[model samples]
Target: MAQQRDTAEADRTLKAKHRAIWASGDYPSVAAEIIPGLGALLVEACGVKAGDRVLDVAAGTGNAAIPAALAGADVVACDLTPELLEAGRLMADRSGVDLRWREADAEALPFADADFDTVLSCVGVMFAPHHQAAADELVRVCRPGGTIGLLSWTPEGFLGQLLTALKPYAPPPPPGARPAPLWGDPDHVRALLGDRVTDVSAERRTVLVDRFETPEGFRDYFKERYGPVLAVYRAHAEDPERLAALDRDLAELARRHDRAAGSGPTVMEWEYLLLTAHRTDTSP
Candidate 1:
């Protein structure tokens, strides 16, 4: 009993740390530039329809939620960061779409069971420290026959490789924390979802990164706006040489993955896994 309580306390501390890290940066700027493509994919893949009650869990700045609302669905956008939720509210207002924005954790969503027709997360929920609890909340809020759409970075993908490159400079993750890239694995996802969902499937897709004139330019942009990247930079502020080495390594990774050969701006392809599943009916 004491062990369980200790574990729970540890999880809460880790989650608090995650929330602070994410809120430290201006993620909306980065999300604005990248989330549209993934949002469109989720809309189509989930077969979102008018009047569908949609929940965008771990929604960052209303990327998928705002688009889902524009599609005529009733949307609720939930995120742990209040700053990001405010950004999402502004974005929805500018786009002439109404969305219910809530500050909530993915692992313990405040919504009731079987409440949504569709649940979507674009490169979001994978970062949750407690993957199983996050998965359970996702399934719990989705109605039977409802669709759940998720986009995650594969271990072999650009974003995954970037994480690997940054690891040498970053602090180790908390004990018992699952790596985010595991969400990209079909088998792992299936195991996570278990028998709670049916018709589970995964597809590999490529999303093009914004073109950059040089690898350094790409690195600079992420450092300025991406939470995790910015956190790493801040952590190494006292060690200039270590930070420089980290930057160089990141730039090298970007250069190697550049899809545009000798161009004014180089395009980079980021591979991601698209997962879709239907919540199983519990009624006898």
Candidate 2:
């Protein structure tokens, strides 16, 4: 019992850390400027339609939720950080779409079992510290015949490599926490959803981002705006030498992946995995 209590406390601490990390930088800006279209992509892939009761888990600023709601679905967008949800709520209001914003943990959602006809995440949920727990919650809240959709950064993608680059400076992941990039792996996700979902389909896709004109620009933008990257910089704030090295490595990673004409703006295609499946039908 003592050991279990310790574990539970550790879990709470880690969850708190995650909430802080996401709330640290200006992520809503990143979502709006860099990866906005991916939300629409996930919504289309999930086949979300009118009147569907949809839940968007780890939905930062309602990226997918807003689109789903605009499609006429009844949407509830949940995230660990209330700050982000509030930002999303405001955006939904501006878009003239009715959306419910809830602060929720992907690993332990508050809704009743099988409450949603459609459940999805766009570049969300993958950040859950506990992989299996999150996957279980995803399957549990979705009706047996309901759809489950996910869009995540692939391990081979630019964002995945960026995460790897930042790991040297970032805090060690909590015990038993899996890397977020694995959600982009088809085989890995298949195993996670095993026997609980059916008719699974996975697609490898890319989104072209031209937000920055140079490698240094990309690195600098992330330094200022991206939460995970900024958190690492904060971790090494007193260590100027290490921070310089991290900056160098990040800029180099961007340069290596950049594809652009010598004269025009920098262009990079960030790879992602789009996976959709239906909850296993268990009706008698």
Candidate 3:
């Protein structure tokens, strides 16, 4: 009981940071920027076809799911966060795509076995507490010979660099904490998936990130948009001085953004690995 509370508290802290980071309309903007490439990669990598039954796990704000639906797939989009799911559904409706939204955890999916022709997640698998179970769950619902497609950001990429820069200013995160894990890393994901899955493959791609007006723009955006993250910060880290320092640091970033204007894009780059695999039937 005590352990659970501790875990919950820790989660709250991280999520607050997430809220602050995404508040500046960057949440949807970045998703919009990346969805086209992510969508095209998903199609090519998984060979998705019209009328396929697709599962989109952690379908944040309908980035991948909307595009997949546009391609004529019947998509079931699921996420752990109801707020994100709500936002995703709204976006889908606005886009005129039919996406079935569900609130569910990626590690323990609520679906029948072999229910989907294809399963996909955009940088979501590693967020599960039990990554192995999550991977298995994804495979379980996918029909034999069906494709499972995913995109995971490399920890060392520009995304990580941005977080690294923020680290010096913000309060420390819990130990062993990373924004998300890259289950697409060959050795790591293979070890997690085990021998049950067949024909597993992965490819690395470069993602161009724009729309961050400046470093401050990025910080302010997150501060407002991500609720869970904001809630955590409000609850914990009762240090006014630290908060003041964060404000100053973000102010400097805002200045940098203004200075870079009329020059060109800030040109932050993120590396992602796209993974594809076939779910093998367990029945003898």
Candidate 4:
């Protein structure tokens, strides 16, 4: 019983840390400015039709949920951080879309079993500390025949390279937390979903990102606005040299991945995995 209590406490602590990390940065800006189209893409991929019941797990600022609601689906956006949910709620209201925003953990969802017709995440649930727990919750909450859609950054993509470049400077991952990019691997996702889902379809898609004309510009943007990146930079606030090294590393990565012609605009394709499967049963 004491061991169980300790574990639970630790889990709470970890979750709190995650919430703080996300709330500390201006993630709403990043979501709105950089990857706004990803949400619409995932919503279309999930076949989120009108009147369908949908749940967006780990939804950050309603990136996917808002679009799903805009499609006329009855959507609920849940996330670990309330700040993001509140922002999303306001955004949805402004858009004249109705959707519920709830603060819930992806690994341990607060919804009932088989409650949703379509369960999806877009570059969201991949950040869950416990990947299997999140996957199981996704399967558990989705009704049989409901679609399970995920859009995540591929391990070989620009986002993946960006993460790799940051790894050397970032703090070690917390215990039990897996690398977020692994969700982009088809085999990894398949293994997690296992026999609970059928008619699995996986596609590799790329989104064009031309947010900055220079690699350094991109790096600087992330440093100030993105959550994870800001957290790492915050950690090195007292150490200018370490921060400078990370800046160089990230800029170099962006330069290497940039495919722009004549330096007119920085064109980089961020590869992501789009996996859609039909839930079969609740059997584990």
lDDT scores in order:
0.87, 0.92, 0.68, 0.91
Count clashing residue pairs in model 4: 0
For candidate 4, give the lDDT of residue 140.
Answer: 93
- Tens-digit lDDT track for model 2 on 1-284? 99999999999999998999999889999999999899998999999999999999999899999999999999999999998998998999899998888998999999999999999999999999888999999999999999999999999999999998888787788779998999999999999999888899999999999989899999999998898999889988999899999989998998888887436678999999999999987531
TM-score of each: 0.95, 0.98, 0.75, 0.97
Q: What TM-score, to 2 decimals, does candidate 2 have?
A: 0.98
Q: Which scores better on TM-score, 1 or 3?
A: 1
Give the candidates in order of TM-score, highest first: 2, 4, 1, 3
Whole-structure CA lDDT of model 2: 0.92
lDDT tens string, model 4, 223-266?
88888888889989999999989888988888888897437667
For this target, which candidate reaches the highest TM-score against the unseen true structure? 2
Give me the displacement of residue 234 in model 4, in angstroms: 0.6
Off by over 4 Å in 4: none
Better of 2 and 4 by lDDT: 2
- Per residue, candidate 1 scores C-alpha lDDT tens digits across 1-284 of 99999988987788777888888878887877754678767878999989999999989888789889989999999998888898889988999988899999999999999999999998899999778989999999999899989989988899988887878877888776788888888888899898888898899988887657888898998888888999999998999998889889988888899877647576788889999999998630
Looking at model 1, the pairs that clash are: none
Worst 10 residues of 2 by lDDT: 257-266
lDDT of 4 at 13: 91
Residue pairs with backbone overlap in model 4: none
lDDT of 4 at 125: 95
Candidate topping lDDT: 2
Off by over 4 Å in 2: 261-263
